[model samples]
Target: MELPPGWSALLEDYVAHLDAERGLSPHTVRAYRGDLVELARHCGVGPAEVTLPALRSWLSAMTDAGAASSTVQRRVACVRGFFGWARREGLVAEDPAARLTAPRRRRHLPRVPSRADVDLSLASVSARLSEGDNPLVHRDLALVEVLYSSGLRVSEACSLRLRDVDRERRALTVLGKGGKERTVPLGVPALRALDAWLHRRPEVAGPRSPETVFLGARGGAMDPRVARRVVHAATAGAGRGAETGPHGLRHAMATHLIDGGADLRSVQEMLGHSSVATTQIYTHVTSERLRQAFRQAHPRA
Candidate 1:
């Protein structure tokens, strides 16, 4: 198979490992590849020429190029990954990018939509498919249902296998960060949507015996990018504005649950978050809502 432009042969090897050995979702593997390709283009050299100072210089160039801190950090990680792969394959005696560090990004609160906003978004998605213009309607609707209902990432939403979804229990096993798998409940909306999608999934999936729950127009795996586009269009079509993305829906899911008096830990498990600390961030949002309510209702004004 051909590698990404400017990708080192070692990167190609590591990417294979990430897929076959690590069970990393294709989306993540692509991200790592994209970052590495950018690094390779900057270094102007092949795998054997990578060095610590050169890596640092690339980081400096990224900073100068006005890359976001988060993006820059990802680039650094990709460079480090290349070195790690090189050492593992015995191409290098020691990893030169070992001591390199990704830049720190200022933490900002995640964006979560209100109930009205989520309703509009979901309704819009549903409305589009009901029109019959797109045969992938069931697939799109099912994806939206699972995403909003279970709070899955876009990658997880699309990668779901048919067997992973348990019809009797209305639950599915989600493979999340670090290849961790967790069983999450699906609501009636998700179940119904999934049922409808299964009815029409074969139409879009041409001729493959794909066990995947969702498929693209070509009968293969749906790209997360396409999932994102569908979501953006649906949300915009419903007049919810175009500010939010799929993960924003995840933020909305966690926040809505908290707003409905659900425990933070329970929210963490639902989102498949590894850290309670990560889930704790939503508490801040709820607290803000409380303050807003208090200020609005109190006579102190």
Candidate 2:
């Protein structure tokens, strides 16, 4: 297949920049680079020739090739980033790729459990509190509380160590995606759950986990998938829809914060989103729901 001249080398440099400077994981860097490879083939020109028309044509070709909307959209974003980087580094004079837009993706909103539903889920865990018996209840409760309260990713929750919790500050330190670290606040319930679980965790941790916060029957770092499965099973029994997972709890945390008037920028930072636009999806969620409610109840059309 025909490929752009020197495009291969430039792509290597850009991918390296993404890895070393941006701290993107090798896997993520590779994913972004895959699209660039296709771009080189499509454009049939070097990085210097990335005019808007060529960019648009590449996207159109992706559409013709029957790429999924999400895939096409991500490739478009990668192209924009590449061109922006190129222009800023003087590889190009003006960013002709600036005006490019990704294919429109079907919009989806984060699912937030309602107030009554939230009470039911939390209360269900509390009510199922093993009454003086089962050892894993405390760990389970702590997991749910921390997930809903802090909106932590499953990996972050599983990665917790003994030293990461600051009891005095009511904060839990998390190593988020891309190896970024952030401090997440611990709510009262989460703290209490953590304390109780720490007590029982010593009993339940199998032989594996030595220092992680939530441990299995053999005392070791809890497996993330198991944590998710526990969340899935527990949420299913809580009467919420089956769609409720640990991520649903995370979404709930973001929505609860927004409804409580937390600024979008703060939530974006707390969630480790790179763009305010990514976080803005919650605004759309809240606004659309409000619109639906208003239209249904309002006296006027």
Query: Can you write out model 1's per-residue Cα lDDT over 46-104, one digit (the tens) per residue?
Result: 66666888889988987998889988877777777768877887877778799998877
| TM-scores of all predicted structures | 0.77, 0.75
Q: What lDDT score is found at residue 282 in candidate 2? A: 83
Task: Give per-residue CA lDDT, model 2, range 1-301, as digits (tens).
Answer: 7566878777888998898888876667889998888888877777786678988888888789898998888887888888899888887788877888876897778666765666677787788785767878878889988998888988889888999999999998888778888887889988998898888776776555567888875666788888998787667744345248798787778887888899999898888787898889888878877899999999994
What lDDT, from 0 to 1, does candidate 1 have? 0.80
Candidate 1: 10-residue stretch with minimal lDDT: 234-243
Cα-based lDDT at residue 266, candidate 2: 89
Q: Against the true structure, whose lDDT is highest? A: 2
lDDT of 1 at 154: 89
Please identify model 1 stretches exceeding 4 Å from their true place. Answer: 1-7, 44-51, 88-90, 124-139, 177-179, 199-209, 215-226, 237-243, 291-301
Q: Every model's Cα RMSD, please?
A: 4.3, 4.2
